[model samples]
Target chain A: MSQLKYALYTGCTARESTPELLSSTLAVAKKLGIELVLLDEASCCGASHLQDFDEFLAYVLNARNICYAEKHGLTMVTICNTCQINTAMTKHKLDHDAELRARVNEKLAEVGLEYKGTSEVKHFLYALVDDYGLEAISDKVTTPLSKYNIAPFYGCHNIRPSELQNESNGGENPYVPTSLDRLIEALEGNSVDYESKNKCCGFHVDLQAPETSNRLTGTALVDAIDNNADMVVTPCPLCHLNMDVKQHHAAKTMGRDVELPILHMPQMVGLALGCTEAELGLKHHVTKVAL
Target chain B: MSRKETHKKVTVKAFRFNAETDYLPYYKQYELEVGADDLVLDLLNQIKWEHDGSFSYRRSCRHGICGACGIKVNGKPVLACKQNAMELLELFNNELVFEPQSKKRAMKDMIIDKKDFWDKHEAVQPFVVADIEEHPEHETAMSIAQVENILDADYCIQCGSCHYACPALEVNEDYLGPAALTAAYRFTVDPRDEAGMERLELTAQMGSGVWDCVKCFECAQACPKEINPIEKITKLHNLQFEQKVARSNVATRHAEGFVHSIKKHGILDEGHLVAYSERAAVVKHIPEALAMFKKGKIVMPWNMPKSKNLDEIQKLVEISQTNKL
Candidate 1:
């Protein structure tokens, strides 16, 4: 029996683009004695794009996912910032709007499911800090990352448009968030503060305005370098992809020589918890893990 | 207690540049005693009147309504007239740093170019263009609910806060930006407007339109009026999908791909999504594709399995139906 359990939601980017996030998340969870019940029945939270199709349909899709968690009697914990926000947005809307909730439950009834609003959504960062105490995590740290000065990148959906996100996801100040910084401190690492820490990753516009997206992406990494940080860690895999895989594109756009290892939040935590690199699927990173 | 008892001292750093007088921009710091109720514009007024007449910035109604007091106070866009100077100092660690909007070209201290901003706003056709001949009776009354539909976008004061806060605008000058998109949304949702579809087509343009929005919430974060300009843009997308307008943008295809993939597998099929969205241009990404494949970022589409409740999800969300996204 695990001490703490959550219905894990491995968002699209994690499941498809970055499996290391899912693997490292699981590895870290096992070490922390946290049980993550895979929400196998879950569908995509629409990735914030589905609302463009049908807001009602997007709401229903997430309502059904939350209903699945309610069936398991556990909180819905997601590793992706997008998933956390999208799910939290759904919960916030359904919990507030009776007519909307009634309609959503009506659609959900077609699948023999009911969203009684029994479950809450949280990011893994929030879950770790809130439910699983930072002190507890500090106790399990076999490898303190004191040598590295890490920059904590809290991406947009995780913090901004704060009304739509879980209010307690990061911190009150969306402009200058400190939760990720505190998490870094818990792992015995120095957190370098930077302007781009809470800015957009430009991943959303990669297909639309490739060069512009790259510049915005590069700005964050460049800001990290300017802040004298060695490595960057993000709670969002989409941020990781843009910062790591597309870093060359960003550098090319900004005309700067920049190379930095971008770690998924779980991978960094996994390292601190003494999990082997192989166990955390470290081989999949685009940038060579400098550590 | 005297009035001085309530006043607190802090340092004010304002961006100083005259374009003609100064070769380069520089920050000039000054000391001031401010009160809790002092507006940022009041401080600027004091700085001009008492500290330095050389310091210059824009000011109009001083009530945050005219949208003239937009500036970057402590690295975030806020109306100088609306924001409390003391609150700003408290929020930003007891120091005030006033600069022009980050992305916009600076004209002088705390003032940026608004010509292009207004040009994009004009491009959106922000007002209603109803078929007046049909309504000879001149009855263009709308119910509260109809007005409520466009109310959020209606709250826009054209402050350029969202416009300046946007990263898309920073990188892509051609991008229509949130203020203009909110304008487009405002008219598109106007029940009385005949040009709703026309506005949609206008916003759906290739390079300079809605698709370029990085979907970052910075626009929403910067809006002083609490009007989430990004949400308005999202509504515009919803309207486009509902109308089933003929469109061929990458963003439209990307959205369609998400719908198709989710309907098929209960989750996204990344390989197919790229192919579906990029079409023949997918070949252009072969280098990055190979790199991703080497790192196991790109998975074999066939190997990806279906979720057990995929059918249940489809049954609920009706993804198989062409009616919804």
Candidate 2:
């Protein structure tokens, strides 16, 4: 029985595009003795698009997300990077701006909820490093990833917009971050060093410029591959979706077959901790990597 | 005398490259005792004056202004004049590698060829296009809110930090980097500018324009002035959407799909979002879709459960003062 529990906010992508991420996250969390209570009532946190359409609507939606998590009397943990940023950004904005909080609270009241701001919202990656302790996870590693070289891709929302996304605020980094690298080392893997580790995965802008977005993904993949990485891992399922499903497109942009498999943070951890491929739902990954 | 221990002996690997002399770039390691109060610029000056006089880097304002000392500390974009050296050193476990902001554009040690940045900025023609004949008084005639809107953006130092930090540049060289796009936005919002439409037109361009930004917010993080270039870029996106200026782009379509899906289902139906955005182009993803379907990643609409409290989501949007989609 683990004391650490969280209202798991599995963002839309995890529930839809990359269900493996959620399953793998569960498998890994189970091993760590952590309980992830689902925030099933929570809807999408606008995905950054809702902000462009209606900033207030996005705010209300995210505020409602926090409210659902607040109901559990636990900190909220998200698997997706966008979900992490959107909810945290909304919480920050509302907490800082009393008027906005009042307005959002009035809206929340309609749905039998109040914007109490009780729950601390964060990504599961941060939850592991912050609350669960890296030493605990490392100590439980039954199968060390000593033979593989992996590149950690800290997707944008995971470590960006540093003003609201600093380490203290439950983010990795706005500048270059080593949190992913530290996690990789904790798993007994040769964490590849590269400059573009914390850069955007270009998934957010993929629809706008497919070529440019593909190039962004390709460049990151090529960077990792060039650095002798066996595979790439990310805490963001949206990033995994792009790196997995859209890898062929990335190849077209780069004019090379850089087909390195992508792993969700939990899948990597789960694998290192002796979780079976079936248990982690590794088959769901469009790009298969043999460990 | 219990204070924060502020001094430490840290090893810094400063990048050394001379296009005129060296065939390849190399690092010159320096072990020095630096105070917690020392900035990156101070360290550079110390290296030049004491360690190696031949080491060259541009510095004028010594403060954060001029954007002259835009370089990468620990392989991340930052203004040497603005960032605390010891602070960054501590962040990266006391090992700092100082290098030119852009490797392809490096002219000398810590000096990049900024011609691309300037050329892109000039392409936007970042100057007011007001008609003096129609309303000359418009220059000084502006409300406080109007000035405030453009004030933060106007403070941009053009420190190619945003440019170097931008991941979009890796894909497209012609992609108008954040600093230039930021300049476009700063000028366009000015009340005196009559060429707002033209400026947006220039930026609304598909390849080398506003649409290319990957929304990483690196530009926002790298800015020493809190310019929030991503905010300006998204504002450009909103303005484009509001004005219906860039109606043909896939980005606009994607935004529309996102809004429509949220409004209809409360949660984005990923399958439908793609279907709506791509329309005919959705055929391209059929293979990918099939793969996901086999894995049960995509449960058909009937199989996928509806999100709970969607009526509340709709009500929230209905009551909130959201922009018309």
Candidate 3:
């Protein structure tokens, strides 16, 4: 096995809104012998909201985060899909456009920081499946979840718009992705095939149009339930919040009696690795998981 | 030559509605034995030609161009000519649900009124305004990098996928949809165009402008040409800031508050964000903020814990702000 080290960037959601995801990710990475060096000085990734308002600020903020990882001589790893895409998109833009790169670097020079474009931004899912191959992961599974039917939801940002994807980062086929499903199979679980598997959880519109969000969320959950999935595991914290926390709201809005448990990808891996429910934050989920 | 040997039976559920005849819009299923290489457009054409002449859909070029055949296949915006029927069948378990783009008034089967879409497009003035002194013979040379910047924006086919998938448009019809705003950005950055600032001014309005986008990214996904309209819109926002156009909107204030809170606390202070972003209207949100506090969604700014690395974050923020253009 190669020596693994990463400057872990826990975005606003994992750091503030859902610390359980952060804890479980740390616990799982440790178990897998991957070193996660925390970049405590990092601020928000300027999120999707900030990008809408000021794209330059978003680029500058993300470049700052990337600069932190480059300074430490480690690649950046993000647990949140939004953070991964924002940082990766900024990296792609800066790398391709020299003028933008020069401008961003000029701003960074004031802070004694420079992005040499050395570090790579990767989602935790890509790291687990690509860096730590499925075969290596299967070898470490002592508590194989043979009975559980898991629905692997690859939320939109993590995979789509193939321009952001690369070979090492799951090299996702934006239309039909199966890397998440493959990871679930490695954990000795059934990856339930269902409609709306690649659908949006509608987390973005939650504040503006709650009903639209609910309908979108409800459709995915209903599909998972119809296919008899024990739980829906996702790589995105926002998706987990919508599918797990606001599921009952979605169900009420859609007038359905659906109850499907949602798990962060790391939590599912931790559970199959014999980690306790409490340690994995299984108890924190609104939709109860029996395991 | 046998019917069973060449094609597989695929179920297509197409949206059917005629306002003059039907009271409500509904789906009508059709089972067609489609060839392996057949596109979704081919399937639609086959149905309309052989199976049912009454089935209505818009299509000019059988290929991916023209952009006239945009529809929702399994609730995702896609061009019918670009999507392979067999691949879609396998993905959707041999069943496909086709709907005319949502948020548009359905005219008939798989056809929706694009008048509003065209109106939004026209609002952006999607054309370059040439300088009167510049003659056609005196062509201005552009760098390779300059062309690459506007390349993606030029790939838009006016398919209405981005427009239909936009959450902002669903909420506020006035919001300039992704495609039009992308067009606005394309011309704004074009070296040959003389009306860059004018274009920015037109798109910087409070309601139906660049700031209205919610940044959902559905437009990027829905775009069959991979134009990534959201990225183009991001560039437009950057241009708006650089031009100092519409600097005092809630969106701009929200961004300022977001950065300020992050620098001060190393994490987002939601209370500060709402208060600062809302400005004088902060008083109006007092009841809402109290309700949120009661619900445990937020902590008061004074009571919030300072992040461990607030000092370092503040330095970075200070440098970035001081060096801002």
Using TM-score as the measure, the top candidate is 1
Q: Order of all candidates by DockQ, from best down to worst?
A: 1, 2, 3
Give lDDT: candidate 3, residue A57.
66
Q: Which ten residues in a row have the lowest lDDT in candidate 3 chain B?
A: B288-297
Off by over 4 Å in 2: A102-113, A167-171, A174-176, A274-276, B1-11, B21-23, B29-33, B51-54, B132-141
Stretches > 4 Å off in candidate 1: A166-168, B1-6, B131-138, B319-325
Q: What TM-score would every model get versus the actual structure?
A: 0.95, 0.91, 0.79
Poorest lDDT segment (10 consecutive residues) of candidate 3 chain A: A166-175
lDDT of 3 at B211: 64
Fnat, model by model in order, equals 0.71, 0.72, 0.27
What tens digits encode model 2's per-residue C-alpha lDDT throughout A1-291? 257999998888877878788888999989998999987778888788767656777788899989888888988999988888889889988988898899888988887778887888888998888788789889999999999999999898878787787632455555557788888999999999886687677888777678777877888899999999999999988788889988988988889987798999999999999887787887887887766
Overall lDDT per candidate, in order of appearance: 0.83, 0.82, 0.78
lDDT of 1 by residue, A34-92 (tens): 99999888888888776666677778888888888999999889999888878888888
Among these predictions, the greatest lDDT belongs to: 1
Better of 1 and 3 by DockQ: 1
CA-based DockQ, model 3: 0.25
Every candidate's TM-score, chain A alone: 0.96, 0.96, 0.97
Which lDDT tens digits does candidate 3 get at residues B1-325?
1123346876778788886799888877888887878888888887898888988888998677799999888777889999877777777667788888872588887888888789988877789888556456675789998998796898888999989987667756787889999998888888889888887887877667766665557788889888888888777766776677746755667665667777777767666775667678678656644543443445555666555556656765665552122
